[model samples]
Target: MATNLFQRFKTDISGIELPEKFTFPFYYEPHILSKIAAQELQNYLQSQTDFEHNFGLEENQKGLIIGKMFGVLVCQNKEGELGYLWAFSGKLANVNHLPYFVPTIFDMLHEDGFFRKEEEILNSINRQIEFLENSDELRTKEIQLQATKIEAATDIQNQKNKIKRLKIERDEKRNSFTNLSLSENGTSNCELVKQTLEHELSEESKRESILLKKMTKYWNFQIMNAQKEVDLFLDKINSLKEERRQKSGTLQQKLFAEYSFLNLYGERKSIGEIFDNNPPAGAGECAAPKLLHYAFNHQFKPIAMAEFWWGQSPKSEIRKHKQFYPACKSKCEPILLSHMLKGLDMYANPFQENPAEGKEIEIVYEDEILLVVNKPAEFLSVPGKIITDSVYQRVKKLYPNATGPLIVHRLDMSTSGLLLIAKNEEAYKQLQSQFIRRTIKKRYVALLDGIINKNEGVIELPLRVDLDDRPRQLVCYEHGKFAQTRWEVIAVENNKTRVHFYPITGRTHQLRVHASHELGLHTPIIGDDLYGTKSNRLHLHAECLTFMHPISKEEITIQKAAEF
Candidate 1:
């Protein structure tokens, strides 16, 4: 029964009913059994002395702080006894085999494993490259090459200047000879003297040209020799780099092939096949897959599963401590949907359902040129992939003969806000220009999950989409758009703060991320499903909007209060 890996619950859970189907994995609230199991596992983590890991919870913790995602899978044995299995995503404390958590699907770090052998070779290649790159011989050659180029340039310029001076002197000599011949006036000796003078001048010009050519040739040879020496080292470095690249690719492919999973029907599929031979790094090593694989292999009837963050959030992504998060889409979707849970009865994906059903958009202001509508929370400003009922669709139906794109700006699906709409092409262009030029003013009111210490401040954070998890953003400095927000606290009550956000730059989920990210406010907005805990709704509303009238050239301002 593998009692060591699977443990019985400490508290009686007989009163709780089991989930009707397996967890959808991508999104779903944890079942009672799964929650209980997670709580129990967290307790063990607090008291366990099996390993040392700094989760950055202490004020002065040392070492590289790495937060982890831990998961629990509830299962029942053939004897009808219910229990749960525990697993952590990836490795903990540089080790794959821990005391209570399930073992990794494939132990690549084992001393005798093929992965280790190949990794050693790869490391050796890296060391060789580094040594050559920093070698005194390479540095000396590079410096000599640069110095040779400078010397050659200076020598060539001097030779050119010398030739110019020589040509001027020759011109002066010809002029003097011509004047002497003219002064002789019809003397045969004078004609002979002029011819001799011309011949001498020609010879002098030829000598100067030859000298310049010889000097140039000498400098070119010196520069070429220096370049060749440098290239010799570079060629070796490039060859080794190519070899390392090929070996790394081959090693990754072999590792992918080694990572295979099993489903309920005894069907086995390799990670390569699951992701079409191009999986992201660490695809099959997440906690959900490991727990499910272990449960299936051990004849445990899978019930429900939940994954939670066990420590401090990472610098780029928003992951609160002890918060339950959905399975990452980029890595887990292909593995779980395509192969692992083929025959299991799973919960219906909530993302597929329309959040805007039975909701309506309220028109706040209407004129001949443009209009404003208060979009409800959970309503889409534009048509989404699965849901077609949106503000754009509704507005289009109302104004069939209207020209250009009906909506000028957009709000997120979960954010309730005032959206500006244009009825004509000219109006749309003018309104859009106002927004682009930063003339349009906007204010959003939100309820934060925690109180902010500062009363008023500004936040500047660069943002980019989390490629692995769609709709989720990361604070990335490398490839991100600039996003800024100014906020002032309105009131603090019941451990939550209400604040007004004035975004200077519009970006997807800018305010939410700026509020939740550790570098920003470090307090997520209440009911923020992506960055914080989910509630009945995301407590953010676009309360005020001010822009110039597109046709009339008059300023217009509209305001609405949040329902939260």
Candidate 2:
């Protein structure tokens, strides 16, 4: 079965040379062989009837649509024949087994497996919880308990009011009898009348106190009974939920243990061990890990590999059809780097190299209170994880006496723009306040990859960072912050649209995402490596800025033209 998984190339590859090293799974340009294999697999997906899955490519396709990530690994067999293997992330068509793709590391969906058996039990517990939560008995008991509480409170208050009125009447009688006794005509009779009135009042007060206690006791009993009935249903629901939680934890641990991968040296490590016993969901199920695991076990020498998105993009993340992407950092990085790719020569990580090397920052404007500089592309506003040379560091070194944080605002490392700097804490606060108040004006020039039909419009798409892949953003309406950009077409030449962007909100990757997202312009900025294809440099530059000077109290404007 594993032998047939290696697919021979369908196209002539005599002119192409194999790569010297395996691909750096985190980032790289797809090798020619990998690209050829991906095209062949895409062709098969378009015409084959081997399986059914809704990728949401059609105008009216039904069912739960999900676009998938597909990968191809170029390899050489023992016979020295060059070929490639295909794999998809997760299960396809509700099953892990398919015709030509690599199989999963573990078959959790096997009918006779422990996972399925435990899943059934978990499902049963879920059903019981749902039934109890939605039962008529539970609903009726809850409603009854609430109504009884309200009725008891009202009745108890009425009894208290009645006792208060009775006490007031007794006091009045005592007052009237004392006045009669003060008169000389009936002194003896008044004394006897006073004694009798006192006794009667005492008896009345005692009776009223006893009646109030009785009323309170009765309402307490009623409320207690109603609450007990409601708790009966809730107790069962809670118990079942606890059982489900424990079972789920146990099952997940067992499943993780079964998904062990083998490296080139035949060293085996489970997903739990790789991720320190806390792997994210679908950790070992990605296309890269599956392909590499199969290749190592079957003795296929890996040469290069690439993964690409297919079909419509997901609502949250931006994934253009047929666009190559890096393997996810959160899920695949730990597994591949720590266990699977051991002893394999691979490309060096580009992120480790400082991109700001040999670039100089040009001073655009300078004054006693503040200044502005023309930041070069691939230069960080502040220090990064591996590299410490940045615009802020340079400015701080130039002005050692400068107070507060020198950098007032930032530009993306890939963006060449005007960065503002403050010389003192007061100036920094004044300039930063202008940004927060939306009083500072900024305009950027960009070259889009595709032509824009509309001349001008506003884009209001919320954005948040993709937790699975840091530095990459997602269009998440639920958890994202508001991001807006207004753009106007400046010119169109060579199938590219040059435009000016006025941002209303400053979010991470605001303009890049708004340019490429389907809901926005649907045209990525040229050389936007995160959102679009990589190029020589990102063609986005901050061309203009307007704000009031802190010391001079006069409005100031600075302009810089983009080199591209």
Q: Assess candidate 1 and give its TM-score to the true structure.
A: 0.87
User: In model 1, what lDDT does residue 382 have?
Assistant: 90
Top candidate on TM-score is 2
lDDT of 2 by residue, 1-564 (tens): 757899999999998999989999998989888999999999998998998889998777777898999999999988889999999999888889899999999998889999999999999999999999999989999999999999998988988898899989999989887776776667667777788889999999999889889988998999999999999888899999999999999998898788899999998999988888888888889999999999998899999999999888987778989989999999999999988999999989888888888999999999887899999999999999888889999999999999999889999999998999999999999999999999999999999999999999999999989988898999988999999999999999999999999999999989999999999999999888778887899999999999999878899999999999
Off by over 4 Å in 1: 1-3, 77-80, 137-166, 207-232, 273-278, 437-445, 450-462, 475-505, 514-523, 543-548, 551-563
Clashing pairs in 2: none
- All candidates' TM-scores? 0.87, 0.91
**lDDT by residue for model 1 over 1-564, one digit each (tens)?**
377888889979978999999999988889999999999999998888899899887668788999999999999876778999999998998899898888888999999999999999999999999999999999999999999999889988997898899889989988887887678777888777778888988898888889889988998999899999999999999999999999999998898788899889877899988888888988888999999898878888899999999988898999989999989999988989998888999988877888888888899999988899999999989998888889999999999989999899999988998999999999999999999999999999999998899999999999999998998999999999999999999999999999999999999999999999999999999889899998989999999999999767888899988999
For model 2, the stretches where C-alpha displacement exceeds 4 angstroms are 78-80, 136-155, 184-186, 218-226, 276-278, 367-369, 553-556
RMSD of candidate 1 to the truth, in angstroms, is 3.5
